[model samples]
Target chain A: MSANPVSRARLFGSAAIVITTLAALIAAVLSIGPSGLVWAGIIGAVALGYAALSFVLHLSYPDAAEAAWDEQNTVAHRDSLIFGFWAVLWVFLVFLALSLTGRMDPAMAFYWLGPVLGAVPPAHYVVSVLRGRAE
Target chain B: MTTKLIVHLRVYRAQAKLTQAELANLIGVSRKTINTIENGVFTPSTTLALTLAKALNCSVHDLFALPE
Candidate 1:
């Protein structure tokens, strides 16, 4: 059986992500020291790996990729955003409390918040999709 | 009167002799969208309902109803 052609949009999106992430990694590492290089390396590796995997999935399973972009998935995405909002709010509250008590550095809390914001929505989205598939 | 949205998409699609994927393609959506609508996991927009009805050769009222 012939494999379905991959979506051009998906291909270009993956390529863009990979390119932007690499550029950001190089800029960060050049501007910062070894510590920043370590963090940037980890983040860059994850971004690159995810982009590659997404591209491969779009290429290998065109039907599933198409399914993931439809209305049901949009509903799932909105639900995940709601979930992420509450989750991040709770995280912010916790960090605020810790900073108020002088238990955590405000700078550190602010630093970690960026990753929390980036991670929560996609994590919730993945979970929501998995739950929907299971049901 | 209290009413709940009731969907009969599966029945209509079956009567129309179309699979979920086929119905989705007819309506320019994905199979999972049709599956979720059929299983009551997702409530489609009015536009989607109308499109589905058009594709299935039925009315929206035939595919969905609000029961009192």
Candidate 2:
């Protein structure tokens, strides 16, 4: 049988998380200063903590780990995408409004866009879990 | 009138003496998926409905129905 769509989405989400974290880490490292060091440390700790948690969960609950990307998860992912689209659009609109009023720099608005867009999936997943809608 | 899909999955699963996790394993899904379907909180796809019916040794109609 073909792989579940939820499973595929989870794989891509995990990849996105890793890539963004790596990019942030690289950017932090390239700029050397106390602030840069602090950002790098914070990012490193978060990445390591996530990896450790996933490893432990996989080892401790093999069945749950295997089932993590099931149909329920797919439904949650789909809902999250809908939520994310609206959220991103709202953020863009707000930024556009501010830029037009000369209250915010367009470049600054664009800089914040990437992180906000990247945050949607994980934020939605957390909300779903809290609502007991997704595993 | 809005029609809701009424799922009889729990009754059949109970008759088969299978736990949610067991049925999930049989159908290659998660226990959460089985639980949600049983509670009528989530509707399974056609493919999943067929797989669940096959796993439970029943027809899709037997496992699910709409109120008349």
Candidate 3:
């Protein structure tokens, strides 16, 4: 079957958003000195711009747009949330186990949690698409 | 677990001369959703099934069925 242009666009948009977000995050984390706040602001602006562009694309494609974007997104969003919850729980469990065994610092457990949370939805989306389990 | 649904979406879509994207647009869903449903990779919710049926000018039962 031929590729659907709208789906391709969505994929491209999602990829751009995810890649940019990750890059910004990595940059922010690595440059956590005096320039950290500046990197954070850049990340926020980049993310906001990417989000706005996606919204504008949706507005431009009436046929491609949802009757209700939130409604249409509900199922996928729900799935992503569930997956993210489980993923975070798993990480927490591992952290707990490590702490109990004195192999990890309890205070450091949550240091990576934010990044883990950020990774979940995109990871879920990619896995779902690969497995053909996407809705 | 896989659903018990059987899909005849592609056949009907072909008969109607509609591409996956066209059918998806008609039903207000993503083309990926339509593609997955057509390939039996995903089971659509009842609301979506009905919407697709209505778009194709058929009943839900006409597009989907259980194995005999």
> Which candidate tops DockQ?
2
The DockQ value obtained for model 3 is 0.44
- C-alpha local distance difference test of each model: 0.66, 0.72, 0.67
Q: Encode model 1's per-residue lDDT on B1-68: one tens digit a residue.
A: 54457999999889889988677766656665787788877788888898888888889999999876
Residue-wise lDDT of candidate 1 within A1-135, one digit each (tens)? 111233333333334443544454465548653454466466556656666867887777767566556666677667767877888799999999999999998986786565566556666654554565311
Choose the strongest candidate by lDDT.
2
Assess the local accuracy of residue A105 in candidate 2 as a C-alpha lDDT between 0 and 100: 88
User: Would candidate 1 be rated incorrect, acceptable, medium or high by CAPRI criteria?
Assistant: acceptable
Model 1 per-residue lDDT at A107: 85
Give residue A8's error in model 1 in angstroms: 15
TM-score for all models, in order of appearance: 0.69, 0.70, 0.71
Docking class of 2: medium
